[model samples]
Target chain A: MVRVAAHNIISPLGCTSQENFDKVVAGQSGIALRKKGELSDTDFQAALLNMEVLKDKISGIANAEAYTKLEQLCILSLNEVLDGVDVKSERTGFIFSTTKGNITEITNNPHAVDALLATTANKIANYFGFKSSPQVISNACISGLAAFVIGRRYIDAGKYDNVIILGADILSKFIVSGFQSFQSLSPEPCKPFDANRDGLTLGEGVASVVLSKADNTNKACVEVVSGAISNDANHISGPSRTGEGLYRAITRTVGANEEVDCICAHGTATPYNDDMESHAISRAGYETIPVSGLKGYFGHTLGAAGVIESIISILAMQNNVVIGTKGTVEQGVVAPVNVTKENIQKPVNGLLKLMSGFGGCNAAVYFKKHGE
Target chain B: MVAMLLFILKSMENNQIIKEVSIEHGKVLINQSEFFTGETSDLGPFLKSLYKQLNLKYNKYFKMDHLSKLGFLASEVLLLNEGIANETDEVAIILANASSSLHTDVKYQESIADIPSPSVFVYTLPNIVIGEISIRNKFYGEHMFFVQPSYNKEELLDYTTCLFNSTPCKYAIVGWVEVNRNGDYSAKLMLCQNKK
Candidate 1:
């Protein structure tokens, strides 16, 4: 079994997983409404990292100014997880997940070679001396969890014993403006699964995880039991109304009868996304499982969403509690689902993470708490 | 440790190369056999003519960006005749490339100053090609898009083998699809199934 040995999340809430977890448990939101004049001509609500603090953090790194903000965030998050571990061995593989890497640098110059995602992956991998060729996964919003599945599959296929998976994407004008064009950005803090929920608030962050064979790691870990991905084959931007893809992915990961203590969902707070997830859970016979969307706490972090949210879910299990779906007041979907509105204590031994992205892609991963 | 090393070596030997398809210089090659040829000068007209000649009826083809159109054309030429598209939950799509959605990115950037086009912006993601193909074929299966410096057959082989070995997927459509800054693009697809 492949297991998560270590993880780190660099976001607006904090720099480390524990810091973000503390804020989550306290119900303190990292989201705030940034004025439109600052990013664009339109005032929008989002969870943005304090650049002053990020600059202070960047000052400690060598030649940080030479790197792009996305690269800096990726390196910073990767550094936090690499402590006391050596990734220079040939057995260690590197995977970078993002929808758009260094895209902020592209700006209006669309032809720049530095805009390539592979360029960012190579720079980061070379910095850490990964002996194996670096791999980059860019499958829309599901990139993070898809990267996890890739890492696990690589290990199971005996390609690598350890893999370092890093995910990062920033809210640049290109990303924000595109979503705004779709009218998917919420003017207020998002309320996932809430009847009044309008749209999602964009967030930016970087998250990393070190996955190794269960027999090779002594650190407290969570075994990645199974993972599956399915497409809606319905629409590129809109999710399937029937939730066919997510339902199949969930059933493929956790058999129909398998007990799930908690569900960490990709509740972008968009009407279609939340409703689609609720229906999928009900169809899969997991409607009663505790479900929560952390978007209210940190907004939707894009490429980093899956990894950051999964790490937070692991933290929730470690604390023996299920984090509430922030900003949600009342249920909205046709199918009944137990959306956690308050921090509830529960034995979250078996946890499931679900994410659906543009391009009709849906991913579900099941993880079991490893030995104490 | 020795036993584990043996297993790794054994799995490496088990990987098999199936069918290969490459599209470049306005020529489509299925296993190096010339399937279609056109003027490489203009991608738009070339692709449109190819779609017409192939007699495809998916009208949504006209609405796709260059990236998705390229992938759609490649898959149609490679798998449409082999009955690969009709299978659901059995086949997987794994593609990789260097320049990700740069063509559409430029187009989207041009429109951002006045009114950003949601139609163009929706294709900003490179993986939308997978979505386009999925929608056309009704393939609700595992699909992934990667960004590599160039087309590396080894990485494709490893990842495809890993998927077939570890996931529920039995067949894989794998290779490279890229649209560079010059608006020049090429797609190479290989259809492989587990032999063991």
Candidate 2:
């Protein structure tokens, strides 16, 4: 089985997975209201990384100024997870996931090659001196989880013994302005699944996880049992009212008789998204499972949401706790779900991560504690 | 392992190339036969003329950015050549490209100078083409969009094999679709199905 060997998260909350988990478990939020004329004329609510701190972290690397902020964040997260890992081996592969990489570069020159997602991925992969060509997944918001699915399959197919997956996207005027055009940005911090939930808040982050085929039967680890991707065929920008795609993806990933102890949902806190997730969870018979959305803390990290949230879920499983939905106050949706509002101390052996994106794409990854 | 074997066997049994379509250099090819040829300088007029020649009535085609239009046209021709009415919703779309949506991203970036056009802003994502195709074909199955420096058929085929083995996907439209601001573009799509 494909298993997680190590993971890291670099966000506003902290640099390492454990650090972010501790802050999140303490109910500390990284989100704040800010007015940056370069990003938007009006004040916006988002979870932004402290640039000075990030600069200090990036300063340790050689020729750090040459790399973009997004690339620097990716390097930082990947470095934390690559301790003693053989990334130079021919059997090791790299996969980068992002919605937009260096998108702000386009503001300077629309034709800038650095603005291309593939270019950014290649630059980072080459920086790590990886032997093989890096693969990139850019399927909107689901890119992070989809990368895991692809990595697991590659290992299962004997194409690689290990795969390093990195998902990163930095906030920019290009991104914020686009959301502002759609008016999807909430004036306040997002309240996912809450009756008063208005809209989603944008955030930036980078996350990394190493998947390996080496068995760790005696040790505590998380195994990727299965994963599936499905399209809603409903709308490009809006989620399906019926939640058809997400429901099918969940059922396909979990299959029959596999227990899922908790769910890490793609709760962007948008009314349509949260409602759609509730319906999908209920339809898949997982309504009673302890479910929570991490966007409140991370402010919808887009491409980083899946990997960062998945790593946090794995941490929760390891610690035997269910992290609460940060900004949610009262349960509100068309269907019923056991949304965890406060940290619950319990054994979480199985976790299912769900993400839906702009392409009518929905992905689910089921992970189980090794030897559970 | 058994699923992988099943996938291999299935490929050997019925994964025939049903239809192939390629659009590049102001020309369209079906199974390597020229279907349409136009001016290569600008893709806008060429795409519009091709749409007219194909007698497609989908108005949404005009709204898509160049990348999606390229992919959409390729898919439309591929499915049209297959001569089937989308028998199943399990048709998967596995697409890869180098430029992603940079062609349209550039345009959207230009629009940001004025007012961010919500219509144009929505198509900035690479996977929006997949969504457009899904909406057009009513396909409610698995789909993924990959970005590489160039087309890597072997990797895409491997991922498609895994999908066929692990999920309920019965067919797939896989290939490369790329577009850039310089009007350099290409779309080569093939339809494959696991025949019973």
Candidate 3:
């Protein structure tokens, strides 16, 4: 089995880890406002963290124009998480995940972006000197999680010593407008798992986690015992009412005997997404796992959600705590899922993270207590 | 075993695509042979027709989706009738790299840009091309796409081997699918399975 370790938190310099932790655990949020395209609401914002604050922290790495804001976050976050570690081993493989892989570049030049977009994953491998062959996966919102699951397969196949799974995304006009078109963006902070939630706020951010054969003492973490990805084969944009793909993934990874402690729901806060995620979690028999979502605090970081939330889950697990769903104080919306609102601190055995995306693809990843 | 590998390698030196069609002015120039897609539905009918012209029929294949159905359809035709399925024993899905779903991407984005439409925003992605094909032919084999300045033999063989070794799909479905701005398109797929 591939072991996953606790995660390191390194957002923009101004976006402190402790602050991120506090906001998450206290159920507060940092989502800023945004509006473009057909979206009528102008009052809502996203989790707009400033990268300019970290300029002093990251210097000397050669960058490309092709490397948009998301790529910039990737380099910074990767450096923070792997401070002393060297990624020179040929046995190390990279699986870069993102919904819009450098699509911002495309907004500038469609012809070039169309050609360069596919190479963004490999660019990281080349940049970091990773020896193992790299792979790219873009399953819409679940892309990053899918990358993590694929990394598990690679480790299972004994094809790599470690997997560098990075999820990055930036709030460009392209992404913001796209979400706005769907009428999915919340005018206010997202109220995931909350009854009165209106919509979600799309944000900009990136998160990186290094999965290796190493132990917990090696990193800040959890162990990835099982993971699975399946397609609903139902609706393209809408999630399966029965949570078909999600159910299969959870059952396959957690198995019949084990029980999950806390769950990281997709929690896009959209009507359909929240409902779908809640249904899937309950279907996985996680009715009372102190379920929560990060969208309220970080906004919907799209591709970054998988890696970012995985990092959040790892950190919470490492600290023997469970973060509550932010901005879900008033139960006004209809939700079949359980929401952990109060500050719940408990020692958990395993953490299950689930994501659903376009192409009807969905993935569920299970991380257990390290050294198990 | 080494000698056999060498013999196979020597034979691959003669590998090449039989047909390369460029859709200029909405008319297809097979350059070598005539081919493309015939049907359409939730997917793109206009583009699927191109794929029907390129793909030759096979017993195993996945149904087309709005995004990749067209590209898969064309690549399927190129693969079956003129490209590699009939000519070689081993095949590889090495797409010189093209949009998995450009039409869908454009449509989806428009919903967000002009109208509030999440249904349309659902399909803006790239891998829809290869995924559609994998399902169509049950081609859970060695497959990958390379974005390069142009095709290079060294790059192709090296990439193919890396792809083959990464997973367990014996036959590889590989080539390039570029939908030009002029509404013209050209794609080529080849099978690179071991004969020995």
Candidate 4:
């Protein structure tokens, strides 16, 4: 692994646009009762954030598309995250994670090729002039978390010692249409793991982390201890009805010296997804671990999920608290898996985070307090 | 100074110079598949079989999704058949070229213009091919994809080596893959190793 500094996190919560997240964490769900796109109030209770707000709060981004919504988010975040840091001298690198990348960029520009979607990270590295090779990781919803895992490994490898892990995506007509068409979008705020849970609400946002070799002076720092990524491979788009991916991610992530007292999951509240996750969590044997899902709070960021949620998990572990499952109630998915409702108070020396995406991609991460 | 440790290899049954290290050529295109078949690792045997079933040669290579197909083929040839090693640190797949995947991208995007299809939406991103490769090959190095108008050695090396040096990986898959409307797509790769 390359040498690296501690990781820092920024979110719609305390970092930047956190006010919105605070409201959700306070037990107020964002899923509105109105209708747009393909969602109806009867199908899914909806929770969504305002894109105008998302656009307003972002730094150094113009909502432009050099390649896709995902590619732009990376630039906007990197410009800010690396503002004080030097990638040129440090040869800082990037590891990008997204389940779905900038699929929208191709349409506006006719004559596009398939390779364009796969080149998002390359565009950023080339634009910023960072020579350290950049890499991409996609493991369904866990894609972002995998990116962070790679960043840490770079440090462990005695490489440049600094890496930028970025997770981002804009809800394109492409993704929204697909889910809505699939009848996966909730009409109201998404009720994750709730007995009345209908479906998920899709939203857009980009989150970033700069993992460096040296100690960063930033207050919002967390050290990643261990992580695991696995594929259920049972189904393509549909998650293993058995939650096999979730179980493996958890089982694979537990390290001997590390302990996970809490978990953050890909609780999209979709009927099938919720049920599969419930079974998977039980199998992981962490029935009592405090669990939460950002989907209720942030909606599903799709391609940007892994990195965005991993940063959120790092923040939760670093703060020693578990954010509520914002819109959860009644335990719709299953029991045993302790879904957090109220912001729980605890001394979290370690934490676990997990996500599963299409293609049976699943991943888990374990974080612990770094030495001062 | 950096003039050291170049290996002389004659390691295959054919003694066909299976591996050779040189900065002189710096870039070479090797086929991981058999001499004629364009098989690859990322898409696995399924895609290889798919190609074979269609009797697809390089003729349709351009017509297929550029990122998906190029990722499978380029990665195989670029990795020198070693496949992505577990020891790699911060590996990024950086490709430079003139036209990005304009054709395939536009078609996929239009299908989901009103609403995206989940299957087609997966490959919409410019760097997704690399992600697919990294995910399948388990290459957790740095993940990045870039589009340049053309190849420039100094700029390419400056950007590429700095990327290699930024991470711990001694080797990197750096190159360009582009598709022409005439159903022509070509790729060039370098297995970059850092100087001690």
Candidate 5:
């Protein structure tokens, strides 16, 4: 069975999974409001990382200028997990996931940004001395979870024994303004699944996870059970009112057994997204399952959302505590769901991670505690 | 051991593709047959003419960027006869490219300076093309968009075979769709299925 060998998270919440998890469990939010003429022309609330902290960490590294902010976040996040492993082995592969890589570089030189994703992957692989060429998944917000699925498949297919997966995305004027143009950015901190919820708060972060064929005896590990992806085929930008795609994906991943103890949902705080997820969960007969919306803690980190959230969910499973939804005060969806507004102390076994994105893409992956 | 090895290899050979199509500047080819061609300057009109030729009624086609338009056109030509359009939910779509929507990205960046246009911003991501195709065809199957330095057919074959083996996917629409900064575009699409 494929297992999670190691995982690291670098976000506004913290630099390590333990630190981030502690902050999350404490119910502290990283999102805050910034006035116009700062990050954007209009006032917006988002969970932005401390640039001084990131810059200070990068200052000690050689040739730090060669890497962009997103790339630096990726390297810093992966560095913790890459140690004690031989990255130059052919049996090891590197996979990078992002919605936009070095997108901020576009204003400076559009030509260079043309190859930003591929070039960034190569740069990180070369830095780590990986023998194999890297793989990139840029499938909107589901990219991180998609990367995990692809990484596990590679190991199962015997193409590699271990895969290093890194997912990252940074905030920029281009991305923020684009979301503003879509009118999907919340003016204040996001309130996911709440009746008063308006929109999502954009966030920036990076995370890395190592998937290995061999079981890890020295560290905590989560088993990769099954994963599936489906599209709504309803609207390009809007989610299906029926939640058909997400229902199919959740059912396909967990099956009829419904062994899922808790779920980490893609609650973007948008009016349609939360409602769509509620319907999808109920249709899959998982309405009573404990669900947590982590967006209130980290906002929506785009490509990193899936990986970091998955990591958080796996940690919750290990600790046997359901993380609470940070910003919801009242239930919004018509369907019934046990939305966890406060941390639930119980024996957690199987965890479900779900995320959906603009392409009408919905992805669900099931994870179990090791030996379960 | 020898017998088992041969059996495994034999089973792998059964995963044969049914059809493949290629779309490049001013040209569209299916199974090595030239289906359409025109001057580069008229690429937009050419795609429009092709869309009209298909008798498709999807009005969203006009608003799509060049990359999505090319992917939509290629998928239309590939699945026109597959009988899986909007009916089957098991046909997976796996597409890869070298340049991940850089043409539209540049255009979108230009709009961000003035006022980010939602129309242009939505097309900034590479996977938007897959969404366009999925919406048009009503495909709710599995999909992924990858970025590679070049079209690696071996990786495509490996992953497609793996999906057919391990997942519920029966037929996979896989290939490369790319649009460089120069506005030049190429999409090599194929429809693969097991012989069972």
Candidate 6:
């Protein structure tokens, strides 16, 4: 089994996984209205990281100024999770996940070589003297979770003893304007799975997780049991009304007799996504499982959503508490799902992390506490 | 002993390359034979002419970005008479490219100078090509997009092998589809299935 050895999350809520989790348990959010003319002409609500603080945190890294903001954040998070791991070992693998890497570099010059996802990924991989070329996953929003799946496969194939997955995406005029054109951004903090939910609030974050094959017999850890990805085959930009792909993914990951403690849903707060997730959950016979969405706190951090939310949910499991869906006031989905409105103290062990993206792509991952 | 036997079975299943299609420099090749060739180097008109030549009824082809058009046409030509659409739900799509929609991303960025067009904005992501193919063919199986410096056959093959062994993936459309801002494009897709 692929075990998560260490992880780090750099979101607006906090810098580390524990910090972000503490803030979520206390019912705090990083989203706020901003008048950043660089990102948008008008005011917008999003969970934006403090660039100044980030620069200070990553200042000690060599030639940090040469890297883009997203790359800096990635370096920071990866550094935190490395923890003396032998990154240069031939058996260690690196995977970079991002929907758009250094996309802001193309705002003025579209021909910038650094704007290429592969180039940025290579730069990050080269920083720590990785022996092999990094595998890059740019599969839209599901990229992060897909990276984990690939990492696990590498370890399972005996090709690598450890794999580091780093996922990050930053907010820019390019991204904000595109979502604005789609009219997908919410004017206020997103209220996921709520009756009054209108749209998603875009956010920026960087997350890193280290998956190792080494057995840690002394401590409890989270094991990635299984993962499955499927396509809706419905529409490129719209959620499937039947949630066929999500249902298939969920069923493929979890067995009929397996008991799930909680579900971390990709609740973008867009009317169709939350409703479709509810349908998929109920269709998979998981309607009674307590479900919560971290978008209400993290504001839908695009590529980082999968890894960031997975880390938070796993932390919740370790704490033996199911964190509430922060902004969900009245659960208003088509299918009846046990949407948690407040933190519930429970014996959390198994977790089902779900995410769906713009490319009609949906992914589900099942994680169980080791030795549970 | 069981693991060794399973490994041998998987290796045996990986030998079959059912079909292959490649689009490069205004030429379309199906299974190493020239299917269509265009005289012009411009991508938009070349793709349009090829679409008409293929007698395709899908109108959405006109709306796709250059990257998506290349991938969509390659998959269309690759699976033309294959009848794999009957088992559409198990067909996986694993595509990689050097340029991740930078051709359209440049166009979308230019539109931001005026007004961001949602139509242009939606195609900025590289995986939109997979979405287009999935929509047209209704292949709801496993799908993923990778961005590599160049076409790495081993990576695609390794991942496809994993899917076939782990998931319900019976067939996969895998290859490299890339389009740059200068109208340069290349797409090489292979239809593969586990013979077992």
Model 4 lDDT per residue over A1-372, tens place: 222233322334333434434454465544455445533212333333354444654434553534344455466567666776677754466776654565554445454453343466677777788765565554446667766665665454444456787776665555566676667777677878888888888766666777776554343446666565555535445777787656766765676566777888888888888888888888877788888887876678765666666665655655667888877877877547888887986777677877776645566777665533
lDDT of 3 by residue, A1-372 (tens): 576632444442224445567557765565655443322334457666665676665454575444555565666667665644457765666766666666654443545543354466556666767665555555578877777776776665445667788777766665676666667777778887677787877776777777876533544347777776555645456666776667766765686776688888887777777777776777666776688787777777777788878877876877788887777885443335568776577887688998876555677888887542
lDDT of 5: 0.85
Task: Considering chain A alone, report the TM-score of candidate 2 relative to the true chain A.
Answer: 0.98
- Per-prediction TM-score of chain B? 0.91, 0.88, 0.56, 0.62, 0.89, 0.91
**Candidate closest to the true structure, highest DockQ:** 1
Stretch of 10 with least lDDT, candidate 2 chain A? A214-223
Query: DockQ (Cα-based) per candidate?
Result: 0.74, 0.59, 0.17, 0.13, 0.60, 0.61
Q: Residue B43 in candidate 4 has what lDDT?
A: 32
For A1-372, candidate 6 gives per-residue lDDT tens digits of 788989999999899999999999999999999996999988999999997777678888899878888888899999899987899787788989898788888877878999999999988998888886898898889999888777887777666779999989999899999999999888888989999999999999999999998566456888888888888988888999989889988987897777798999999999999999999999988889999899989998888889999999889989899989988999999998999999999988899999999889999998888654
Write the residue-wise lDDT of candidate 2 on A223-272 in tens digits: 88889888888788999998998998888789688889999999998899
User: Can you tell me the CAPRI class of model 2?
Assistant: medium
User: Candidate 2 or 6, higher DockQ?
Assistant: 6
| Model 4: CA > 4 A from native | A1-24, A28-76, A99-102, A112-129, A138-140, A214-221, A370-372, B1-105, B113-196
Kindly give the stretch of ten consecutive residues in candidate 6 chain A with the minimal lDDT sum: A213-222
lDDT digits (tens) for residues B1-196 of candidate 4 = 1111110111111112122221111122343323333344233343455346445345424433655575556565445456546523334454544444454545555665354555565444445455555544555444444444454434344444444433344555666655543434556665655553
Candidate 6 local distance difference test against the native: 0.88
For model 4, the DockQ equals: 0.13
Better of 1 and 2 by DockQ: 1
TM-score-sorted candidate list, best first? 1, 6, 2, 5, 3, 4
Q: Is candidate 1 or candidate 3 better by TM-score?
A: 1
lDDT of 1 by residue, A1-372 (tens): 898889999989999999999999999888987877636678888888877887877877788877888888888899888875668776788989898787766675666767998988888887777888889888889999988888888888777888899988888888888999999988899999999999999998899999887774456678887888899999999998889999989988896556699999899999999999988999988878899899999898888988999999988888889998889998787789999999998778899999999999999999878556
Clashes of 5: 0
lDDT score at residue B147, model 4, on the 0-100 scale: 47
Query: Roughly what TM-score does model 4 have, to 2 decimal places?
Result: 0.68
In candidate 6, which residue pairs clash?
none
Chain A TM-score values, per prediction: 0.97, 0.98, 0.89, 0.83, 0.96, 0.98
